[model samples]
Target chain A: MNVDLIDLGNESRNAGSFVSFLDQICARFELDHAAYAGTNPVASAVHGYVNYPDAWKHHYAENGLHRIDPTLLVASRSIAPVDWSRLDHTEGFEKTFRDARDFGITNRGLTIPVRGPYGDIGMLSVTRDCSVTEWEKLSRQILPDLQSVAVHVHDTVMRSDVLSRALRYPALSTREREILQWIAAGKSQQDVGDILGISHRTVEVHLRSGREKLYALTTPQAVGRAIMLGLIYPL
Target chain B: MIIIVDALNKDRFGDLLDEMFKLRARVFGDRLGWEVEITNGREIDQFDRLDPAYVIGLDDEGHVVSCVRALQTTGPHMLSDVFQVLLDGEPPLRSATLWESTRFCVDTQRLCRDGNTMKAVSMATCELMIGSLEYARRSGISDIITVIDPVVNRVLKRSDNAPYDYVGSTKQMGKVPAMAALLDCTEERINRVRAFAGITHDVFANEDTVRDLLDARQLAFAAQLGESSEWMAAILSGSEEALPPVLPEDIQDYCRAQIETAQTEEEHAAALRLVAVLVRERVHPAMHRLVFQS
Candidate 1:
């Protein structure tokens, strides 16, 4: 399992031979199914290759089954390796459990979750048609590697934008950004004062302070610079 | 080096925590008018001890700045009681692997706001978050969930316009005119309207209303629907009932993705990458991504 985990990370970061490398790991781990789920938190765009039937994905997306997908419940919050057995079974879940079984996802599974700055989350799941004993064996054997691979990949995914922006723009404190954003929104000193509950003069001071820090000539220029640098976007 | 001092265990951190609290009061309380007693001028909370914390900003000598506290989940916390309401009947996340990054107070006296040093502080905070994610990465921690005020929530919720890395449920609890925002909505637009942050009065008019943000609120799902329908859908939209991705995993990916794509005239991207590397080196492993870097 540990070797398998190493292989997975090596494959994901290779940037070449990606698919085959991943497929080999998937097969070595005896995983009946695997997926790389990328979520857009803003759009609620949860896209991944679940071993579930295509019908299920379609239904989940079209009919919004994600709204009721209890598996996601734990996936959304848990920060560790989770065994499907630990899930809180929905009443009558076993009655229709065959739906998941047909898709090879019901046998037994483990989920390795990862999170980054600003609360982004991702998961690496391995499922197989093994008995509880076998599943437990697999989970224990690979949990470390699962965590490692998930973490590394998740880290890489988040830093993908570095080539675009400069190096020094995101260093301001929360309060500074809070004040700058208010001013950038076309708010007058008095208006900014009202929003943040500070004196208009204080708003003036913050704006001036930001202007001096950014080395901009005017208030509007400072606002433009902040926006360009992703410093103070609209709230 | 960032330190996480406990606001509740004031005696432990002593002067630093006291000074931190006073700064908070001056910046948030006196500024925002939450109206708490500010004997020395600082706003403290119970949850300060319940999560792994850090005052990871900067000092004035043009040097890197930070403070680490002892407000970890294994310790005391304000949310266990005051914010337990948000969890309701469900077993929402509250664990060690999943730390709630708390209490970001900078020593303004130590920080130099000249030459984009403010950018340095912001990047440092982002770095701390990224580091926390890395720490969680090695462990079994699956998420990094925390309660945010309306202002922070609104900024992140304007997902349609602003690029914030978060996904969760937003419920309107309590009752009419007093409903709580559960953060379950993905449409980054139309986030819950918040009261004034720096305020003693409600002089802030209702500028951006429910109507303006509804579409942004439902942004995640808007692509699949019609334009007008997307806007109309979010306001009346029901819950995803689906769980949000674990906070740590979600954030890590989001921040990395953002770092990869961020563009700016200043050095925001370098700061972002540097911070990302530092976060991966220091903080817990996580899934949250921060796109706020330029």
Candidate 2:
């Protein structure tokens, strides 16, 4: 597709633009297919030049793998990009993993699990079928950049400001705004507080206020609203 | 890091549409066993322009693949306030959540379509549905409803429960499968669903309305202001071409096995050989041309 990376770099790191840029990247990598799915109530989905079977996706969703979505769950808990193969498959992942593999998921894959300031959990992943040597080389070579790219695209598509837009409120103080922003970016209260030099309680207060203003009943909802509003970026 | 969402610029709409078309042709061709229509590339609907398609998901290359194609029903769609007869005399327009997630398609032909991800109409649709609920919930939209094909509606029903109660019935929509409606799309109904289905909430249609809409053909209705009440019958049941759904348990495993085995090659190597043989045979005469190029 010959897209300008700088343009993608400019977009807030969210799932949308990440999907877009990935399309270009897939072309660059000479790959044929890809997809990006956000873990939300509505569970929005994005697609790359490649596509997957519906029966498979339906099976995955119908089976409710998000609870045990090892990649998504683990990625949510960390800021590092993980190789799909490196994840622990010892327990609670037989069906999901089997299904993923049967569907031709690359044993050699990378998922940059991103946690924003407010506990917004997302993953930027890349998959490919390659020899063990080639896989190792690609992981060592592209893993670092892939993590950053995943974060960037994740933050861009879901650009924060989801708070006010959700509840019809004005923007909050930059610090608090930044906190909500981080929250939408997928960071936890302790993390957000630590980043802003505030107590977890204080972070809670800011989030509570933001949550109230956004009229969100749950933390995930609050983060979702914040992302929709452009109040935060997944950097 | 935080992720932000902004509507795509108008300039990029064409770029997006082209992608949508190609994706649809790819997926529908393989998954549903349907023909492809890419003359001008693909089909464009009235809703495509009015609604901003929201695509979210990661591609295999760790990039974003946005599938944004839908329109909120603020005015009228489907039954069009036009040459339409109301199954419900007054058209059940109450405080309900209803929206048509229409012409949903995704490209599945290329790129080893992901099993975890939705491709073609399915993925595009799932993406739209997921994002729409999140967006609508945040936007304080309560009622949400959609009238979809029966097979598609069954998929929705199986996945999660909606807030408002809905009514559904199969209709002779032609083709391999019949069409049906899943009613009960109210914000309140969706909220209940969110609580129970343990997912985000989105309103869907009311079941009674759905039934009334389909069964209206059986009821008596006044043609004009002073016209006699015309007693109608056999609206939903009139069609002779539509096949009825069998109980899942009732579906013959042996028949399915036969089809699977028939397609097998390598001198009857079971399902695997059958599918492989089918792929080889079809490709040689058909799929082969499409696939060999790859």
Candidate 3:
């Protein structure tokens, strides 16, 4: 259960090294599978890394399981670590569980939700094949360690810039940022222009540009996008 | 701050979960008169037994202020189990990426004063909404089936988070007419709620923060004293006048009640020690500061 934080921290800066680290973690914990999926759900961007069987991955993708995977569905609303069996055995879940089992995904599993700053979200899941009684005992024994590991794994992946590459956000210019800041502070275009010693038309142009960059349809939407992107502060 | 508790982290949030269940009892069983199972001041049901994930909001003092429980749609949830009648016998929904959220409530009576409950309710509701969507979006859930009464639906719309669509006709479930409201877990919805609520900062607390908060609460509970008890009133309230020169016999009765409830001898001694310290601290207030500071 002991993780060499120094090694994990140093190796996480590189994508390959991080994947190897995840593999080592899986081995250390006797896990059959380990996965880290960092996604920008807003942009529909996903960057996933896992030591799961390649066939299973292909099957998951080919079937579009990402759209209806109950584990991930529950992971979305969860901040704590989750057990796969804890999910309700409702309608479509049997197929998912069956498919995963067919691909050697064990019945005993845990997924931890990780939230990064500014709309970055990810989950770290570990799966193993064991009886329910054993799974319960082992989970209790390693819960704290697993929690720590999940955070470190998330931190490593975030440091590697994999998600940033997949989910690229447009940066705002200094002028655009300032205008958006004023708008967020409740300044009208005319008021912003007057306060900044610019013309109202110039203010409008900058705001419009900012809005376009943020993919926003209106001023408030632009402000929201900017705030979410850390481009501007809210008043 | 909001804490997401699932099977892995539920152990850490045991006290908070109990608090949330009690709050649910008050809101659903007492206030709304839902025919829910209430035992020992908690409203719990089979869904809770299913190990559903809960997004809980805590105040500065670590009290449960608002909460919502999420169950995977592939399994038994209120919309499919207890309230299937609302669907009018339609085939139950089974999806991997959709979740069911229920037991949404806020501590309105606790948060409000002077008949000004609207603002408190609005703030808590908006915060919970933001927390839920943010969590949902990250977890890869695309849609949420929320089984809500008409009054709760109105609250959502008034808070600027109208459901994207309704799946079933409204039908009586328990005492209120309920329906299945489908909400998309998208950035646009989160933005709309944020703008409506005027909330700009992240509502989530980190694991370390949650651990610390829960640990402090556990210690407070172990002493059989609420964290905001009169024993520490002067120090916490920042008003020396809150404590009298000598302990009142009634206050001593309160301390005695807690001490007498201690299950173990060590716990009894610890509680007694705490009572002695509080009494001594009130008479020599500077001693309390010196002891803690050193």
Give the number of the best model, judged by TM-score.
3
Q: Give the lowest summed-lDDT range of ten residues in model 2 chain B.
A: B225-234
Q: Chain A TM-score of model 1 versus the true structure?
A: 0.53
Clashes of 2: 121
| Interface RMSD, candidates in the order listed | 16.0, 18.1, 16.6
The per-residue C-alpha lDDT of model 2 at residue B16 equals: 33
Predictions in order: lDDT: 0.43, 0.42, 0.71
How big is the RMSD of model 2?
24.1
- Supply the TM-score of chain A against the true chain A for every candidate structure: 0.53, 0.54, 0.62
Candidate 2 lDDT by residue in tens digits, B1-294: 001122322332333345455455444444554433444435444434433333333232222233433323222343333112322222322111223333433333332345444324344334444555544443223334444445556556554542222322334332333232323323454454345445443323232343344235223222221121110111113331232222122222432455444421212224333333433443345544545767
Order of quality (DockQ): 3, 1, 2
**lDDT value for candidate 1?**
0.43
The C-alpha stretches of model 3 lying farther than 4 A from their native spots are: A1-235, B113-117, B217-294
Q: What residue pairs clash in candidate 3, if any at all?
A: A68-B96, A68-B97, A76-B135, A76-B139, A90-B74, A90-B75
Each model's backbone clash number:
163, 121, 6
Evaluate model 3: give its TM-score.
0.49
Task: Write the residue-wise lDDT of candidate 2 on A28-147 in tens digits.
Answer: 554433444443222233322223456656777788876676666554433234556646553544556777777766545666544332324456556677787886675565543343
Ranking according to TM-score, highest score first: 3, 1, 2
